[model samples]
Target: MSLPSADADWWRNAVVYQVYPRSFADSDGDGIGDLDGVRAHVDHLARLGVDAVWLSPFYPSALADGGYDIDDHRDVAPELGDLAAFDAMTAALHEHGIRVIVDIVPNHTSDRHRWFRAALAAEPGSDERDRYVFRQGRGADGSEPPTDWESDFGGPAWTRLDDGWWYLHLFAPEQPDLNWDRRDVRDDYLETLAFWADRGVDGFRVDVANLLVKDLTEPLPDRAELATRTDGNHAYEDRDAVHEVYAEWRTLFDSYDPPRMAVAEAWVPAHRRARYASPESLGQAFNFDLLTAPWDAETWRRVIEENLDLAAESGSTSTWVLSNHDVIRHPSRYGITAAAGQPNEIGYIPAFGVDPEITVDTALGATRARAATLLMLALPGSAYLYQGEELGLFEVVEIDADKRQDPTFFRTGGERLGRDGCRVPLPWTSAPPSYGFSPEPAAAPPHLPQPAWFADLSLERETDDPTSSLSLYVAALALRRERAAGEGLTWVPAGPGVVHVVRPGGWHCLTNFGPEPVALPEGEVLLASGPLADGLVPADRTVWFREA
Candidate 1:
């Protein structure tokens, strides 16, 4: 009912909702969400019963990669409002007993950032250029990139400027990677961390936490033919030196009275993930297995067990996430494919149903999505939820190709549709136009066009129906808080493709992942993701019960 009854360690088991500022609720009729938008909706989070809110980047930026290309770590974007608006939002969240987890993009900076501008203006090897990951091109006349590492957004990691030198940008060309080896870069972040903590932020979600330090000591190899690897031995990503970066952050953030917490977006292999969340490193490195797991029971069970085990190994609580701003919404994903297969690699990005020429069954996706929610919430550890998921929002894959803005879309030359679908503005009211995302005289057409069908799934419509997705989320969250599952998990062999788990307090959660009906273990049905039929546990359904 309040900030957690527990100590500062609340994040260990918190349900931190992720808010993508561009799409959440827009105030001032800007058609773009702002700090004030979040301020007005703090009660929505509080009523949903989440412990905290993890806000996506709202910093000043060119938005080259949708705000991941941050220009200022210490200042809020003028469009989103100034520092005063951010402070007001944080205060409002605190008033509603919700923790604020601001995103920290230490991996890269927008090309428009002052540091990058100075680097470009100064001569090669100058102090300004040294502050970033800039290097002279290896080829004669400097035509070729320094290395062959591919940018996550697309093309070569190095973007050649007018100068002979090329700067590294693991993502879009507009987002130049920072030189973590530089003392100035490291020291500069300390001030940024303190600036937000002083503003009463409870924690930070470190972006690209594992790729800070690069292995630029040697002649960078051209990875033109190299494929993506998940194993932790990358030249730049998940490097051993990156772990030290988080450790320093831990010490710096701990200086705060309540001691701010941090979660790393490190996309390392299973074996190496614990290092990032160990006692000395960032408090929790995201456990992405669940997000990438197949909808089958065996896979979900394994993901759950492995995540919990790894958290124990590191002496940190596990974190489970279904979807985020960058990925396709779970419901749409569940509908797109009958089976949820493994990811292409460690940091594989889903193309939002664009990869395959198939139509998604939205009804089926919604059913399984509700089941997936129960399975995740019943597990022991924290859960990260993206906004709009609670409203059963599906990916808007049909948005006109011309309306797409993701750098991935342009950089990949339309091969990938990018994340524009899932980032559509939230539908607050059922009407057309802004749908309550913005007020009258809407601003800039919502950044991305909202689908017409959104009116059917608006919060206003859902709240009127008890069986709506929003209603289910509220009820499930209430039960989750009331009967908190303990740190223990025991799996009962409930036949193939059925995972029945019993946590402490005699609570059991059973999910039937197959088409065949599975007999329920003797218990009282406390909650079900879907309607029960003939007292038999239906396939593709999940239910939480108390053992008789």
Candidate 2:
């Protein structure tokens, strides 16, 4: 496949910043972030030089599935504000030269969704009922779940509908999987895409995109044989038919004047399945290899090499993410722990089994955290910065049982606490009340004070301080744009744990993940996130050297 012309593929080198709207910043004091809140932060993102902002699901929902179970695709959630606020946000982002990409969940809709409600109320075998997958059991024996496969949140993947049939729920029971086989469903999705496109949304960060279509006849794959489980939800993910769905979406998107990019959240290994996101299909797929790659020189080299090779073979731009709303925060993932007596050994034990008050310290300190940020920003491809990541925020240590909101955490008998730790509110100020998120009354009665860490680390205090993480991120982003590293980069293998990335213009980036100083073949140090004198000390340190 020939590469798209450089002028035509500007998104190939774009950097996307993801915002979990609920936690970003609250403008109306509803104790929740809203569209207006997002508008308030657009300037900050613009100054940071991100190419686009990907807002996680802000659509109307019952809040059962953390906005993934969307009830209305066209309207914003009431808590997030109304259509007018959304328009204002779009305008603000565009004014700052930042594209806006909202999340689109096409696979399933909240059971409360009007479509699902109507489908349930309709007689079986009726056209409305046919919109969703409804199957009768082969007697009492088959009435249970079709397979032993568990939902990503745990328990059976199938839920018994009030109409006496079973419906598949790849994630939560409240989220009934839509029957993509139904022409109505497919048409509805196309219309939804058009609706947003007409609204000026530049693109979409498709959620569970690979699960949009499923093997209607085959039983769910056995979990034991799968290579990996994402959020513990693999029973119905990555069916080959998903490719067809993506191709259809790609065609629809191409019909528009300026082609809209679709970024899929696929967990397939980068090298083995890069073709899934070929130009003919979706524009890009998330690169989990970088997120889960071992913290070592050789591992990093192999992963990047494989990724680049895959990109070359598939002729598709790669997408990289360090953390998102669904997983543990990267700082907690890579930070060293003193309790573990090793670097980058933080354990993300949820508040289920352990004593609610237990605290385990990680050895990774401020320096290591800084290094990780530098490496993430320096990487080539579309970098996804999770909301609050720029502030060097760590994972929330304590989550009360009542405070827990993730369905995955509750479904797994508390085995996997899900993503509640990372989904906590972003701290905009140090003052105690509401953490400056919103003035709205707390969702739960007897509003609780914002966590203490918010005071310890906040954007208000750090944004202007040169030594703060927020300042560092701003500076790095400025450098990234000024040097045009946001453009495609050429990877040159230097040695283990050290690689030279040549970006557009005359810029060069050298990354050393090892514990010892690396000798640059020839360059002058432009920026160093760790002890430059030591070459490259491990546990989160990156050195950028430019050709003199």
Candidate 3:
């Protein structure tokens, strides 16, 4: 194996790609993606110029919550691959000059996990049960749930056991919340970190990083009361105690050669997000405010500036994300026109895709999505790209209800369409069967159904088309690697509905969000998201240039 690079701050301006294992590729023709599949596709990432790949949960699980309900923190899922397969995949990615960042679920574990199973069989107040949040009934006859806390997926957070006790689960009932207060729980995670680091894993993407250390004190405060407190003392999300856990993680990360890094998946406000990414804590925290914002100049500008400023307060660079496995793809999100002449908060809304009033202009959405990618890549810090986004894939909103696997789908009784649409398997070739996703074209269907429309958006179709979304990403990423290396970002004055920023390396980026074409600034164009109209940047386009 090669030695680690000397540039320890490689994550600062890096562009990372998120790989949803089950949807990326299937090597064994089992119709499910595996580690061998990922290894086979390292060229795609290397070609796209991503510095690293942040793999979503591939640990042993029942898929109750789409692999987030991890049954074993230190091993890979059998369907995906074993530890040897994981090592081979890591080595392959490293050979292609890409770092590896795997998801670490610290907050919860699957109900089938050894610890959870042991806890279920143990007495109520035993050490086994103490490892998780187990509470008593609230009302007479012990029939009522412990508290009224709601699951993030939907319904109630507490599940009543047959023994008259209840267990807390902030998400699906199959994933029990871990009690971070327990010494064994904390120690086990520390060991988990070492296990991966020893196997050449470069970093970790901590799942639900802020929700780990909950304030599960008695006379449990209601969500309203918890929301009203700014004291950093909360029931579940973003409690101050979470930082202490990250601090411990940071020390562990620093122990590795060249020092491994971590980016937190915390859904807190801009201010608290900085703390999660503080130097003493995890090195970076995802800034997802841009993912939900409408395609408006003012809104995008405000979120960018606020994130940059707040991240600076904690001496950390901001991390920008447009879409992930959990949300609808940006192409579809941007396609929908709001009813009241106002831009809709796409991913943040409840029951996002199932609304009958929602209408998506696919063409317009793809255009805006490309423009957004350029803008995000031009920013001062790191950026994350979801898999298949380079192909400009849209959400497969027409999946049959019976085929959905997301916990949110069943938990909400299909009221919320959930994230299955976005999690559909990616298309590599335009042809039939599994669309080159699996080795056997006649193999069983993918874990989640893929739409027939994917033929047009397959990598094979766009691989050689210079104007295609995949090519745009390849060219933009190449330029970004050279031009965006510096940290400087100076905003240039532009007309209404336009964003212009100058980088330190003579690089200038401008994005036009208005309805009309705008005159290009005096410069030699390096790259453009789409074709320029008569030397003018068209609406919903982004351009990068150097002063002529």
TM-score, per-candidate, Cα-based:
0.95, 0.88, 0.98
Which number leads on TM-score?
3
**Which is better, 2 or 3, measured by TM-score?**
3
**lDDT of candidate model 1 versus the reference:** 0.83
* Top candidate when judged by lDDT against the true structure: 3
How many angstroms is residue 355 displaced in model 2 relative to the true structure, after the best TM-score fit? 7.7
Question: Which lDDT tens digits does candidate 2 get at residues 1-548?
Answer: 11222334656768788898887877766567778889988878887788889999999988787789899998999988998998889888888877878899988999989988998888878887777777765456556665556777779877876656787788898998888887778888889998888777778888877777655555545557444654324445666666777788889888866788778777654443665668878777777775665467677667766776677677876666667787666666665343334333222344422543434334454565566667656666667888888887767746777787888777877777777777788877776666666654645321223577787678788877877778878778888766764436677767666655677665766666666666654677666675555444343567666777
Estimate, for each residue in 330-388, the C-alpha lDDT of model 1 and write its tens digit: 88777765245433222224454555645578898899899999989888889899999
lDDT for each of the candidates? Answer: 0.83, 0.72, 0.88
Worst 10 residues of 2 by lDDT: 344-353
What root-mean-square deviation over C-alphas does model 2 reach? 4.4
